[model samples]
Target: MSTPKKPTEAKAKPGEGVSRRGFIRDVGLGTGAVGVALSPTAALCAPPALAGPGPVPVTLTVNGKQHKLELEPRVTLLDALRNYLDYTGAKRVCDRGTCGACTVLLDGKAVYACNILAIEAQGKNIQTVEGLALSPEPDPLIRAFVNNDGLQCGFCTPGFVMAAKAFLAENPNPTLDQIKRAFGGNLCRCGSYNGIRRAILEAAKSAQGGGKNA
Candidate 1:
């Protein structure tokens, strides 16, 4: 019988074998499996990659107090207030700069605290709802909110108070329509808009008439 032909090994085409995408996918799966298989002690012994940029020293002035903090630059003023400083009056809702729940006065203007970085608020007068009632006697604005039944769940109350404080400070005698427009940026999920407006107007009137009916 004739000798069997020598078996030939097939060569992969130049562009064949695992594609770049397939290689990446396989490597990723393999790496994940390897990680999963590793003991906790072994995993701990491995150097970890950085999770984010290093924290930086930042100083913020809030409600007339100077606060020094070490934080990542990405931290927002709302976080700095509620998280670091324990000033929880500004609620962290609608964090995308839409809802005014985190509203505060930056240099006497209403601004969304969530929209501003803590670094950006440095050296500026940052007024939060907490500062609005800092006096020994309750502020007339607070009195107005309570007297007018301006809130229900009260989650949105602090922000509404700050917005009204800023609005009345600018326009101490704002009309009903003006009060509504002034608070347009803020939202009350409790549907207490009319009561909020009334509170603002009453606060405005009290501000103008020296707080007798606030």
Candidate 2:
């Protein structure tokens, strides 16, 4: 009888004969490459560093006083006044220029303090609501506002008073329509438009004579 032939052993294909250890090593190398590419320290993946100028000495003339401050050029006049100089009369409501809550007199013209830079206000006359009451008695505009009840919460009162002072200086005998047109930049959230108008009118009349028609 013929000897039984041994069963032929099966062999894996050439490319499929990888060892388990080799497969694991290849996978680990690929993962390491991916991590290195995505690393924040890598040149291509890094973000650019940003730098700005440091604070510099700034001289601000506010409320008839010269204040020497170390301020960055980007600092707003309102911030310099409220934060640095401690002139808190200009309310910081609506930091954007749209709200007149930060209004101040810049060289006798009404300007939004938040809109101007502290550096820009150098050598210019600056007047805040607090400056108005420097006298023994309150300013006539303040009296007029109180008499006419031109404020509610009073957050916006300082700005309104400053704007009115600037406006009345230019047009002491302004008509109601003119007053409305001039105060277009200012806003009163308390809906005190009527009282404000009347207050302005009263102040104008008081300026001319006692209770004289505008």
Candidate 3:
């Protein structure tokens, strides 16, 4: 009969094998855990490093609520709203002052979203189209759009709505000529300006009667 090896010797190899595996696992997972823990904080505290000189922290009051965000110093209000805060109602088009597609409300005034840098809007009450639908949404303006068929592609509708709200707030009862002059800057390729104008008038009338007039 062949002689059997010692159990103590066998036990030593098994112990070594388990220790080796534990060492490998710890080494492999150590950096990954650290990376995960730090990434979310970096996102919350720092903006993406663009090819710019520096970044700025901005506080925006949107829809009667305050939000704190870190953004690149050069980022526009449109991009910051859509990309960072996930408010994408303001459409980005032309990106210059030519097209009014990215219109938003700043302190109850209409302003081009793409032109104003996000950091410049600090301490301002910035209202986006997203808020338009929040308080009993499909308000007078949205109802008018539906009734008048004011949207063709619907891309420029948000800008028009923002402009109209500002206009009506200024002149609750506006004539056709006044309405045309008020919304002159907004452009629509679908030729829906006529419908949009009528819709605004309807909404203004509705707003005059406490948002209940059909």
Candidate 4:
């Protein structure tokens, strides 16, 4: 009987199983694939000399002052105020639009500064908590807040002040229920709702007497 032949496995050499032409084509295709994958972020770290999105010139009028700022298009009005212009009266709580801590008056209407783009506020009059007390004496709204104890930590006070200021402007005289409804958008973590309502009511009284115009 002939000696049994041992089974041997065949090892593939470099490019042995594939045609040389196919191997070269696949390598080229792979390089192209890698280039495509990296193309999106290739320009991200490019030097400023390279053509890419750059800072944009934006003008924002705040508290009766015109401010020229160079900011990225993605910057929010809140960031421009607090970060750039040093207007920290609008507390930087709840960077999102939800908390109402960044409330401000845009053209006399209450808006969340965090939701508004700085560029979009061009030509519109903006009012912040700092504007509320421009004179030597504190405004009635501010006084009401102090007297009524509407603030605990005071983080949300500026927003409440601006919101109340806007609401009182539209409705100089509002009932307690109306005050509650008007401030529905604002949330006080300190649970000072009763004091806030009282402050608004007292401010309304002052407005009724024509003590100070908001």
The runs of at least 3 residues in candidate 4 whose Cα sits more than 4 Å from the true structure, single-residue gaps closed, are: 1-52, 210-214
Total backbone clashes of model 2? 0
lDDT of 3 by residue, 32-118 (tens): 644754677755766665322233456777777776765555567886777666677888877787678888999999999889987
Which lDDT tens digits does candidate 4 get at residues 61-141? 888988776665556788778767778888767667888999999999999998987778889999999997888988789
lDDT tens digits by residue: candidate 2, 89-185? 9888777898799999999999999899888899999999989899998888988999999999888899999999999998888888888888887
- Global lDDT of each model? 0.74, 0.77, 0.74, 0.77
lDDT of 1 by residue, 1-214 (tens): 1111221111101112456886677657655655654669656665664221235567777778887776655568887777677788899877888778999999999999989887778899999988877789888889989998999999889888888888877887777877767777888899998888888888778768854334
| CA-only RMSD, every prediction | 19.5, 25.2, 18.8, 20.9
Name the runs in model 2 displaced over 4 angstroms: 1-52, 210-214
Total clashes, candidate 4?
0
Q: Give the TM-score of candidate 1.
A: 0.73
Can you list the residue pairs that collide in candidate 2?
none
Q: Under the 3 Å rule for N, CA and C atoms, how many clashes does model 1 have?
A: 0
Q: Quote the positional error of residue 123 for candidate 1 in Å.
A: 0.8
Please give the lDDT score at residue 94 for candidate 4.
67
Worst 10 residues of 2 by lDDT: 6-15
